[model samples]
Target: MKWTHSRLFLAIVALIGIVTFANLLQSFYRPYLPTITSLSTTNRSDVHENISHEDSASRISSGQGVKNKNLDICENPYLQPGYVWYSNTTEETNTTWVPFYPSLLDESYSSTTLETTGEPVDPYTSDGDPYFPTEQPPQELLDVSPHPWMQDIVRHYKLYNSSLALKQGGSSSRSREVLEREELENRLHWLRNRRILIVSDSVDRYQSEYICNRLGLELINSNKGRQTASWCHIPMWNLTLMNWHIASVSPTKPAWWWIQSMQIVNVEERWTEYYLPTLNDTIGMNGKSPDLILFHTGLWDHTYFIRAPEAIGGKASWARSLNWRELRFYMQRVRMVITMLREQFGDDVPIMCRSVTLKKSLPSNVSILNLDRAARFVCNELDIEIMEFGEIIRGYFEFYKDMVHIDRGPLSVLWANMVFWYLFRTQGGVEVRGDLIEMPSNGTEIVNVAKEWNTCHGDFMNAKRY
Candidate 1:
C-alpha cells in the first residue's frame, strides 16, 4: 500500500511539471506574437491609407470637385505637358505695369523742374527690375491721379497697424457699415464655436501664434516644439509630431520602416533630400484633416541648392541659371507638392501660400524677382491664394532680425496683419474700416494700355522711361 501511494505521488508531480512548462511557453511567445501581428497590420494600413488619402486629397485640393466647377475661376494651365513653355512666353509678352502707391514710394524733393522729351515712358522699364522704380517722378506725376486698383492696394497697404485692423475687421465689413454691423453680429455667434487649423513651417509659427492670440484662439504648432506658455495670451495647439534633426544628407536607402518599427525617438532632420519624404510622413500621420492648411517650406531648399537630374524629367536649363536655380527648384518642388495636396484636399481646403520674407538689405544676389515670379506662377496656376508678405517685408526691412527671421517688435505686427488678411479674405469677411480706398475708373485700362504700348516699342520705349 505504501509503494502504491509513493508511485501516485510521483505521477502527480510529473503532471504538475508538464502544466508549468506549457504555461511558460505561452507567456514567453504570446506577447511577442501579438506585437509582431499588430505591427504588420499597422504598416499595411499606413501604406494603403497613404496612397488612398494622397490620391483623394490631391483631387479635392486642386478644385476638381463637381461643386467647385462653378466656383473655381482660376485656370490651371500648368497641368498640360507643354503648358509652362506657352505660359512663360505668353506672360512675358502680356506683362501688366501696375503702379506702386505713391505713399509707399520714396519721395525726393528737388528744386529743378523735370521735363520729358520723347514720350510718356513706361515708369516700370528703365528700373531694371519690373516691380521697383528707378527714378522718382515729379510730385505732380506722382499725384497725377490714383488708379482705381492702386488706391485699393495703397489703403490695404496702410492698415499695417498690427492687431487693431484684424480685431476690428474680424466682425465688420470694410465696404459698407450696414453689412459690417450684420456681419459683426453673425461673427459673434460663429466665434462661440469654431475650430481652425493653421499649418506652417517654423517661420510661419510666429505669425500663426500672433494671429491666434488676437482672435483669442489657441495657436497650435503642427511641428514638434514648445513655445513658452506666457509668450501667448491665448492657448495655442501644436500638431508637430516630430522635431527635426537635420543631417547634411538623407539616408541613401529607406530607413523610415526601421525607425518607426523600433519606435525610435529623434528630432526631425530638415535635410534637403528628406524634405519631400518628411512631408509625406507628416501628411500620413495627420490622422484627421484640419480646416485650414497654411504651408511654407522653401527656406531649407533655398539654402541647400539641391537639384534633381534632367534624366528625371527636370528642367536642364535650370542647371545654367544657378543664380536663380535654387529658387526655381524650390518653387518646382513646392508646385509638385502643392499640386499633390490640392488633388488630395480639394478646393474647400483654402490653401494660402505666404511668400518668403526677404532678408534686411536685400542680398545683391538674391532678389524677390524669382520668388515673386514663382509665387505669381503658382498662385495663378493653382488658383490658390497668396499673402504678399514679400512686398511688405521689402518695404519694411526694419522688422527683420536677420536675413530671414523677423524681429519680435514690428515683425510680430506684420505677421499678425498678414494672418488677419488671409482669414478675412477666406471667411468672406471684408477689410478694416479705414482699409478700403477707391480706385480710378480707368486705372486698369491705363496700366494695360501702357504695357501693350511698351511691348510694341520694345527697348526703344524702355530707354525713354529712363
Candidate 2:
C-alpha cells in the first residue's frame, strides 16, 4: 500500500510541474505577438479608396493607428517631381509622415478676372463693400482679439538675443547657434507630421535655406529642381519644406517686349500652372494640407514695373502690359491670388503675406513701397494675415541690400524667427488663453477682424460650392 501511494504522489507532482512550465513559456512569447492592429491584411487599394471620400479635416486625422514599423521613414512618399536627396540616414523612425489621400481640385475650382483697376470699391457703393472688405487694417487686426494670443506668444519669446534688440536687456547672451538649435528642436516637436510651403523669391529662398540649415536638414536637390519648385525634407521631424518661386510676373517669350507687344495674355496663368500643381501636391482630400504657407511676390513686381532688362541682371520679364500707371491692376492680381489660395486651402489654413522689403538701388522706390502698402491693404480684404516683417524692417535701409533684400545677420534671423513664431503660435495643441489666463476664452471672437469668413467650413460639399 505504501509503494502504491508513493507512485501516485509522484504522478501528481509531475502534472503540477507540466502546468508551471507551460505558463512560463507562454509569458516569454506573448510580447512577440502583435500588439498593434496590422494594416497588412487590409488591401492597399481600399486604403486609397477610403481616403478619396473623406474630407480634408477628416483625412488629416486618419493617421490614428499604431505607428507602422515596416514603413520606411527615410523614404519621402510625397516627394514632387524636382526634390532630390544628397544624403541618407539609417536610424529607425519613431514619427511618421502619415500617408494621406491627395485632394484633387474638382469642377469647383474656378477662375475669375481680377479687376484691372486696383482701386478699392467705393465703401458707400451699392455693393456696400467696406474699404477693407474682409478684415480690419493690419495693426487693428493685431489688437482687440481673443486675448491677444499672438502678442502673448511673442512676449513669451526672449528674442532679445537678436543683435537688433540689444537695448531690450533681457535677451540671452547664448551663442546664436545654440539658441537656433534649441528653437529648431521645439519647432520640430510641434511640427511633427506637418508641412510648410514657402512661396517667395530668391531672398525668401535664402530664408527657407536658413530654416533647413538650422534644422540640420540637407537640401537634397540643392539648385537642381524645377525653377518654381524646390523641396527640403527633415526625416526626423517628418517635415517637408518647399519653395515655389512665383515672382510678381510670369516669364513669356519675346522677353521684355512681351508686355508691350501683347504676345501673351492671362499672364497669371504662368503662376497658376506652377503654383497650382505645387500647391495641389501639398494637399490631400482625405489627408492633410500644409499647416502653413508664407508668400511674397511684390519685389519681383517692383523689378517688373521698372522694365529692367535681364541682361542687366534683372528678374525675368513676365508682366503683360503692367506699368506704374497700372499699379492698381497689379494690386488686383495680388488680391486674386490670395483669394484663390484661401478658396482652395479653406480659411483654416493660415496664409501670411510677408511685408514687402524694398532695395534702394531699385528705380521709383517710393512707388514700390506704396505698392507694398497697397498689397497689405488688399490682404485685409482677402482675410489673410500679415507677418509684419515689412513694418519691422521699414526705415532700416542699412540692414538691406540692393534696397529689397535683408542682410544675412540679425534681420534674417529675426524674419525666420517671426515665421517660426507665427506658425507655432497658431498651431494646434498649444496652450490657449483659457489654459493660461482666467478669462472666459470661448472661441467666438475669432472673427473680430474678418466678419464675413466667420462661417464654419464644416461641410466639404458646401466649401466646394464656394
Candidate 3:
C-alpha cells in the first residue's frame, strides 16, 4: 500500500513538470504568434476618406491619426469665382469659401480688455493680449455666433498649409535638391517663393499687418510709421510681403533714379529716390525682389496736399470741389508712378493698381471717388489689373473700425482669398465661374460698386428664378 501511494505522488509530479515546460515554451513564442494586430494600416484609406468629409473646422481637433503621407496632386479645388459676393448662409449642398469656420474652443480666444490699437488681429490665433481686434468685437458675434471669423481663419490657414487644398505643381519621387527646385517653381505656381510689394498709405497697412499675423510671419520689426516700408517674410517658402508707405504717390520729392534717367521727366520730382532705395533695401533684406507690385495713393494726396478747403481768404476747397490743377497733377503723378514702377521692376513683372478706397468723410469721399475713376482709367491704359478692394468694402462703411479701414474679421479673410484666388486662377489651379461676370474691360462709366452692390449680388440666383 505504501509503494502504490509513493508511485501515485511521482506520477502527479511528472504531470505538473510537463504542464510547466509546455507553458514556458509557449511563453517564449507568444510575441511571435500570429494573433491580432493593433496596427490599422489597412484602415488608412477609410480614415483618409472619413477625415476628408468632415468640415475644415473640425480638422484641427482630429489628433494623431494616420496622415495621408502622399502629397496629392491638386487637380481641381472648390474655388468659386464670380464678380458678385457670396456666402453659405442657408446651408446649401454646394460649398462656398465661406464654409470654413474655425472652431477652436479655448476660452483664451476671447478678448479680455478692450484695445484701441486700431490694427486687426489674426482671427486664427488671437492671444487676446496683443492680437485683439478693436474695442473687443461684438460679444454677440464672437461668443455664441455660428460664424466666428477668428476661428474661421484657422480652417483656411490650415488648408493652405496642408495636402488637401491642391496648389498647381509637382508630382515625383525626388532628391532633396530636386524637391526644392520644384518648390521654387511653386513661387509663381502657388505664390510660395513669390514676393509682393504694396506701396501705399495706412489703409493698406492694416491689411498688411493682419496678413503677416495670419500667415505666421514675424511682425516685431514691422514699421508702423507713415511713409516708411514694413516687411514680413517666411524663409521656408522664401515669400516676402512688403508694404512701402509712400503716403503720397505723387511725392513732393524727386526720385534719385528718375532724376538720373530722365533729364526732363515731369514737373513733379520723382519719389523713386526715397521709394526705390527702400525697394532696394527690401530686396537686400529678403535676398529677393518683389515678383508683384500692388500700388495705390489717394487719401493722403487728397487731404494733406491735394485739397485744402477754399480758405476763409478764398484759397481752395478742402481736398474736394475738384481742384482741377491738382487733380490733373494727381492723374499725371498716377501715370508717372506706374511708368516708374514698370521701368524699375521690368515690364514682365506684373503690377496691379488698386481702385482707390473712399474715405468715409464726405468731401474726401467725393475726392476719393474721383481718384478711383481716374486711377481706373490709368490702369486700363497701362494694361494693369484692378482688385475691387474699393468695391468690396465700399458698402460696409458701418464696419469701418477707424473711419478708414473696413475689413477685420471675415472680411480680412476675404481679402486674403481675393488676393490668393487671383493667383490660383491666373496660375490655372482654379477656374472662373461661368455664372458671374468678369470686370467689364470696356466699362464706359466708372463702376459704382457701392450703389450697385446689392443689385449685383442678387444677379445670379435671383435672376435664376426670374
Candidate 4:
C-alpha cells in the first residue's frame, strides 16, 4: 500500500498511453462523421459511430492533401459508418421500417419511435429504418458487401459456415463467434422475412440465390427452373425470391412459368395478372406486397420475338435488335409491365427494371445495347428505377458464367448492392437517381474508413473504376 514516487509517475505514464491507444483505435475505425446527411428523416441514430467523411468525393484523388470535410447527421443519413438502429420483434406485422430519415433524433421529431427510448437497446424489437447503397464499390474484381456493417455480414457468414470456423476453433473462437452472432443477428434482423420479387431470366435467379447466401440463408424447394418461372423459399428468414420466366415484355411465345401451358394470347398484357396471383399464393396475399420487385426481360425476346434485320424469321441474319418500330413497341410493353406492377404492389414497394445483361457472342451482343437503351428509356419515363448491371459488366465477357448469367464475384455482390440501394431509396423516400453513389474509376471508393485516410476524392476519381 506504500507507493514510491517513481512508481506513481510510471503509473500515470501508463494510463496516458492506454488512453492514447484507445483513441487511436477509435480513429482507425471511424475517421470522421457525417460526410453527407439524409434529408428526409428526423430520427438519425446516435448509437453507432457516425462517419460522413465525404469531402473526398469533391476533392479528387492525388498523393497530396487527401483532405476531408464531412457533413453531420443533420444532412444525409446514407453516408458511411453512420447507420440507424432498428428494433425487430417476433411479431412479423409489428415492425416499422424507416420511411424517412430526418436527423439525429432531432427535437423536432418526437413522433419518431425507431430511436432509443431509455430501455435496454434491443434493436431486434425496436422500430427500425431500412438503410442502403451501403456498398461503395472499388476497381477490384472480387468485391463483397460494400459497406462496413454489410462486410460484417459476409465475415460472419463465411466464418460461421466454414469448416474451420465451425469445427476447428476452440472456446475462444466459439466465444468470439457467439458475440459476433448476436451483433450480426440483431443488425440484420430488418432484412429477414422481407420478400424480394425477381421477374427476369435465370440470371436474376442466381442473383436471388446470392442475396440469400450472403445473408447466411439458402434458397430451397427449387423446381424445374432455368427456363420457366420457379422459386426457392427460406421460411426461416421469411425471404422468398420469385423468378417469372418471360423472354420479352411483349408476348412472343409461351412464358417459362411453372405452368408450362401459359396461353400466348396477349401474354405480355396478361403477365402480371398471372404473376401476381401466383406470387400471392407463394409469398401469401394478406394484402402484404413484396418489399422489392426487380424485373428485366429481353434475352428471350431477342431470341424469340425480335425479327432478323435481313430476314423476317431468320435469327442468324438479324444484325440489329432495335429498329424504330421495335424500339417503340419495346418501350410500350415495358411501360405496360411497370404500370401493372405499380397498380398491383401499390406505391410503397420498390420496382426496379434490371438492364439487359451482356452476352459473350457478337450475335447475341448485337441487340443488348439497343435492348438496354429501350429499357432505360421506358424506366426513366415512368419513374420506375433502373439497375444498370449490364452497364457495370459491359464487355467483360469473362465475368459471364455462361452466355447470360454473371459469375459469382464482385459483379454478383454489386448486383445485390444495387438491389439494396434501390430498396433503401424506396423505403427512405429518397429520390431515386442512377448516379447517387460515388463510383470512382480509380479503384479508390472506400468502404473501409481507414483506406480513405490518405485517398483523394471528388473530381480526382477516374471516369470509371477499373
Instruction: Pick out the ten consecutive residues of candidate 4 with the lowest summed lDDT.
Output: 136-145
Which is the better candidate, 2 or 4, if ranked by TM-score?
4
Which portions of model 3 show Cα errors greater than 4 Å?
1-189, 220-226, 251-274, 277-289, 305-319, 425-430, 434-466
Model 3 lDDT tens row, 120-184: 45556445445543232333222221122223334344544543223334544344544444443
**Cα TM-score of candidate 4:** 0.56
Over 121-220, each residue of candidate 4 has an lDDT whose tens digit, in order, gives 4567554434232222221211111233335446556545663555555534545666776666554444454556777877887877765666656654
RMSD of each: 26.0, 21.1, 23.4, 21.2
Off by over 4 Å in 1: 1-199, 212-223, 226-291, 306-328, 364-372, 431-466
Ranking by lDDT: 4, 3, 2, 1
TM-score of each: 0.39, 0.47, 0.49, 0.56
Overall lDDT per candidate, in order of appearance:
0.36, 0.48, 0.48, 0.50
Candidate that would win on TM-score: 4
Q: Worst 10-residue stretch by lDDT in candidate 3?
A: 71-80
Candidates sorted by TM-score, best first: 4, 3, 2, 1
lDDT of 4 at 347: 51
Error of 1 at 372 (Å): 4.5
Better of 1 and 2 by TM-score: 2
Q: What does candidate 2's lDDT look like per residue over 80-103, in tens digits? A: 111111112221111111122222
| Global Cα lDDT for candidate 3 | 0.48
* Number of clashing pairs per prediction, in order: 35, 11, 16, 34
Assess candidate 3 and give its TM-score to the true structure.
0.49
